[model samples]
Target: MDAGAAIWEYLGADAPVADLPAMGYGEVASGYATTHSAESVGIIGGGYVGIETAEAFAEHGLDVHLFEMVPHTLQPFGAEAAATVEDHLRKQGIDLHLDTAVEGIDGAGSVERIGTGDHTVPVDLALVGVGVAPNTELAEAAGIELGTTGAIANDRYGQTNDDQVYTARDCAEATHTVTGEPDHVPLALTANRAGRAIGATLAGDPTPIGEIAGTAAVKAFDLEVARTGVIDEESAAEAGFDPVSVTITAQSRAHYYPGGEEIQITLVADRESERVLGASMVGREGVAKRIDTVAAALHAEMTVHQLSYLDLAYAPSFSPVWDPVLTATKVLHGKVAG
Candidate 1:
């Protein structure tokens, strides 16, 4: 919905909009929601939402062009992971335009072309998935205070500044476990958990929700991309850690296993404390669940060295003797110790 509004705002005209209903960020947009068809389509933003939407349209037989203002897509997952997905997208026939911005949209009654200041791509439809903002109008109208994130100021119990008012879901603020600062992540799981905690609190049980690591997963073509905690160098630094990271490619199963798959793991840790700050993975299989394991480690405040020694399950058909997570941690342990 936010993405659709941005497209109309950029075009400066009211145009027919098409909504794509997707389950989470990874799943392809369901075809049931698409009421119209186009020969060519333009997508702005190269993040998870944009990438999935682009793939969905292309699969429906439309020529799709994607634009990203940054040098690459999937910025949240960092550069190397972005490069991996970029290679896959190009191979899948997506016309990618990185380091590019959509300056305007031109058409008569609907979208026809997308302008990028220097160049234009002819398209029958355009989709914008840049980002979303908190819906704070009602809170503002009620005179409830908002945090620096522009989200409704709420305590751990999900109570707004006014004792009688409360906010949750996309409009509420939650604390980041590592940074210890309020952040508005607005993910589905976060909202659901926060709602549960708030319900418990209102019932007089007073269960406070713990801080979150902002974990997420997305599927790009055949690749399962997942990240947990703080993988971005800048975010890690801002959280008061001198970040060191290492990326390694390892097998998902035993070396001799017939169906073994390649898994890429990037581990980030603090140079001084050696604590594991975050991790990301991209693979054909076994990516999403592994990221959850890393998220649990982050919640428990485990160090990279500790993760390297974790007694993870191992089987010929499931994981290597040293799981990819442990393997990456072992390599990261050396770097942090050195």
Candidate 2:
């Protein structure tokens, strides 16, 4: 499949910072190569790739400046989650320029600086992590239908507009499990799973590409951030659910355990139906695995009541008697039950 391109069109014609000597490390592929060294690097966009790259560059001792056009990074995770991450990023000395627009990239021969309206940041290297869209030029040229998300239109079996042609990976549109609507999550797992299903289809064994929950996890500094399903209240309500959410800071392990840490979990559920919608979690430990449990719950359509009583395994070294996931669900179950 023609997955996608690293260069966002607005970043300029074919080459990103084409005339500049700056580097572009792709979220997927190594976007643009770099041979030059730099003391300072400017990262454009503060979404997943941008933030992760910024953290990496910062760790390598580069003065990192991350610019986001939005008021906050990780807007999909909402303000609270974004703030939690932004605070950590700030603590690590990442220069965050939120709600700032890049006026232009200016330099004599290579990128010397990037200008936001109020300030001009001198950057030795400029890395653009502005995100990517589906590579549908070939799909479009072949008269294939594109979904609302601009990815190639496909069915559960991954057949495109032309039955003989198929689309998978980042280029294909997927249906969200919660809303049962067309979505383009473009995550590695989604791409890999969809690709497998398409392979089965081509082999005469039609396997359904399951609905996506938009489950994902990323590590930002000391934080393990994970999110899944319909965590957005507005989106849940729009999907005909009366969404109610509860956020709690709970211990990742037994309180008396030596390695215990605080894990913040935000659980979303339907007030009327009592079914769990989604969850957002972040912590220094025990977050990544816990988020997978919620993803399973989402797949099973488990209610907060069900999730609260999941009978998960627990040990002081691993989790508390009531796992953080359980604590979050139990708390949400109370609100929904009430």
Task: Residues 1-338, candidate 2: write the lDDT tens digits.
Answer: 11123332222235433444334333323322233346788889988888888887787678999999889888667666788899999999999999987787877766789857568899877887788899999989989999988888888888887999988879888888778888888899888888898899899899988889988888898898889998878889888999999999999889898978889888999888888888888889988778889989988988888888888998899989989898888788778888
lDDT by residue for model 1 (23-75), tens: 24312222312433467889999998899888777776779899999898988
Q: lDDT score of model 1?
A: 0.83
Give the range where candidate 1 is weakest over 10 consecutive residues by summed lDDT.
24-33
Model 2 bad stretches (over 4 Å): 1-37
Q: Estimated TM-score per prediction?
A: 0.88, 0.87
lDDT of 1 at 152: 88
Estimate the TM-score for candidate 1.
Answer: 0.88
Candidate number with greatest TM-score: 1
Least accurate 10 contiguous residues by lDDT in model 2 = 1-10
